[model samples]
Target: MTTPTAQTASSLRAAGREPPLPFAVTLDDGRELVMLRVLRILPSKRIVGEAETAGSRMLAKLFIAPGSTRHWQRERQGIEALAAAGIPTPALRHAGELHGGGHVLLTDFLADAASLSDHWQAVAGLPASHADALAVLAPAFAMLGRMHAHGLVQDDLHLGNFLVSGGELMVIDGDAVRSLSPGQALQADQAAANFAILAAQLPAGWDEHIAPLIDAWRQDGEGLPTLDTAALRERITHTRDARLKDFLAKTLRDCTLFKAEKTFDRLTIAVRAEADELAEVLADPDAAIAHGSLLKDGGTCTVAKLEHGNRPLVIKRYNLKNTRHALSRAWRPSRAAHSWVEGHRLAFLGIATPAPLAMIEERAGPLRRRAWIINAWCPGEDLATHLAPYVDSGPPPAEAEALRTLFATLYRERISHGDMKATNLLWHDGHVVLIDLDAMQQHRSASSHARAWRRDRARLLRNWPTDSALWRWLDANLPPA
Candidate 1:
């Protein structure tokens, strides 16, 4: 393909701008292809672009990294092999090294196709019935089973690598495809492993549908193994948990870190906020706290309402009561950190909570003086206040259902709000939003979870007092451990 000259490269890099579209690349056979849009940019100086030659649309992948020709060749071999085996994949048009030190591969572009990942997101957003969701996903399971029956294994098998077009599931990115024997079916163990890879990508809270999906897969192939649903569920859960932990670690590490120039104090903002404005607040937190509208002023902590960029927020300041308390909290993580992490954990688990904005901690040498956490202010009455009128008669059906959903989510995730008093829950948008995440935690041991669960229920019942109608209703309707 045509090499980018120094002048062209300079113009592309002007003002740190990306290369403009509708660029042209000439193949070794003197055919000129014009790229219309960039698809993806990979590490190692590789780019995939949507290109056109004559009147046909094509996908062109260019690799500029040294020794990329071998990789390109391997991908070509995979595509050819799968295509020869009657597997659906893009048709390869050309593969060759460019005049410069790079390589390029061209393939026919599948128009009107969406990646399985994108399709899943769209379907999940729709107000579709459970049957509709199953119909959409069942075909993907069948296709996966068929591939394993044919002894084809995709090393990087994820929803993103498959495409949905014209009511058919098509596999792409053939570079990772492997075959056991020329035509022999995969072994039972290999099939199970491949199935686990696909299962790990299913959306959370869909564990109930695993058996049905497995049945659908088995209907498509005769030689498939009889997968143990429980065993497979464990494997999928383990993989999903590991991936979530890694994602959370990376998110926290890469979040914006703000340092107060004058106080040498530090703050970390989880969500995007104006650095200068936030820094001003962190530099003199006491003054800001004093000026803001106070919500609570207790011996151990204080809460206030403040605004940034015309957006209201609630800031909770955890105070060190005495010299002993200050010394104890000096070299350890502040309560603000715990709240920040628990808030994110709840969000990740799909539980409703006020959005956490930022966390600030002040220290004197090795002694931490105080810490603060800021969250988006949500307008709603606390659950106890909201349910006061219904305590004697029990909540309305809709409200009762909402409460049951809240507890069900917590139970399914093995999470317990350490202080589950009704005041810590809010009635908003027809759902219960959890607050005061400083003590929220997920338990790994069933016994520990049961103990915390009992405590949570007891605290919740205290709001209703005695064996009131509301208490009786909750006792009947709340999910069991």
Candidate 2:
């Protein structure tokens, strides 16, 4: 409904025309939308700078169009259905008809305090327990399932539209959401077609997420239309056949079968390949520091002096075989959620982690079939080495200081080092370092809603009970900060 008005002003005789006034832009599609400016900044060399905050300051997204009341009602009802099913779309901020055959709908920007795409790159290479990935990604799949269960169709299935805040993915953009009614198998087919369109837009690797998504859809069934058994099985089969399906198995097998030296060598090759890919994609690829393996040959998965591109970094290839929990998921993190968790922890805690680099699915080959984590390198020394002599005799002053600093660091960020064993800790210069943090507990209040939240909490606590207690005791016994 907002129209452009001319601001008439008498200017110097030869003055040129002024720039166009920023308007509230909204699309017309039988729905009303209002564009709210939450944050505005000048483009640098034509590229928009990323929003560093949770987009508390953001512009409104408007979707407006003219259509019959019945059509609008269907869409509105669909939105309501999704919201009712606990899928957090924007609350209807406002709606109204314009003078012309146009309408507008306004809603809050779906901003994630932590986006999975944003953080997954950082921890992709961390040495995580097998259960860690599942702990993080299962809920995300559940979220997607809830949307589908409620008869809400996600028209756009790209990674960009999905937001991960407080350890959950909330769907936005309702234009493509399809709310189905009973006896509407045909309509459901249409919805599926729309989803197919979106799927075609996704990268090749993302096909693996589909089955879990459909299963989630079924589990979150809220009196909504259901996929037939044959259809469901077909979806599951397709997803199982994706390239990532065997990655976990291969990665675990490699960790067990390969020697430490061989493992490091494989890691190096993967890193080099990743670097080549990054060189093609990154804006300043040269600025990125790539490291292959930190500690190999049965040494602790730790590093000393990351020394990569003058940017302190840590890159860990999680040995998924080491943890008992990994066995449950067949020794692979579900949905790669562990990497995101760890990445967010390092970044939010103001640790010396470089901005996340990239997440490359490292495969040994088509025949051998192996995969592993390859992350940006961090600069530091393994705490095990730093503390070995100390534990043998007396704790070194440097080791104590390192531990103290690490505790303070994680505490400040409210990130718990879930597996804070001596081997996973690191010491560098005068700082305590935390590595292999993909499995750490870093949930927000919102994440507590996941069905698996309580179970995960209990399991996490059970697996690391002594560690948590010891950390608490250590905190109490340590000298005052």
* Index of the highest-TM-score prediction: 1
**lDDT, residue 316, candidate 1:** 90
How well does candidate 2 match the true structure in TM-score terms?
0.34
**Best candidate (score: lDDT):** 1
User: Looking at model 2, which ten-residue stretch has the lowest summed lDDT?
Assistant: 43-52
What TM-score goes with each of the models?
0.72, 0.34
lDDT tens digits, residue span 184-235, model 1: 6777777777777777666456665687788777777757767877777777
lDDT of 1 at 31: 71
Pairs clashing within candidate 1: none
Candidate 2 lDDT tens digits, 1-481: 3453221111111122221233322333333222233232211101111111122433232222223344345545656666776777656644444334333344544454555545444433322222443344445555655565544556545444556655556665455566654222224554454344433332222344455445544465454454454554444334433423343333333222111213321322222224444433222222222332335522223222244444444333333354453444443543223553355346533454433443322224321112233345545666555544443344456555455555444443345555545555556545555556555664444343232334433332232234454334454544333
Each candidate: what lDDT?
0.73, 0.41
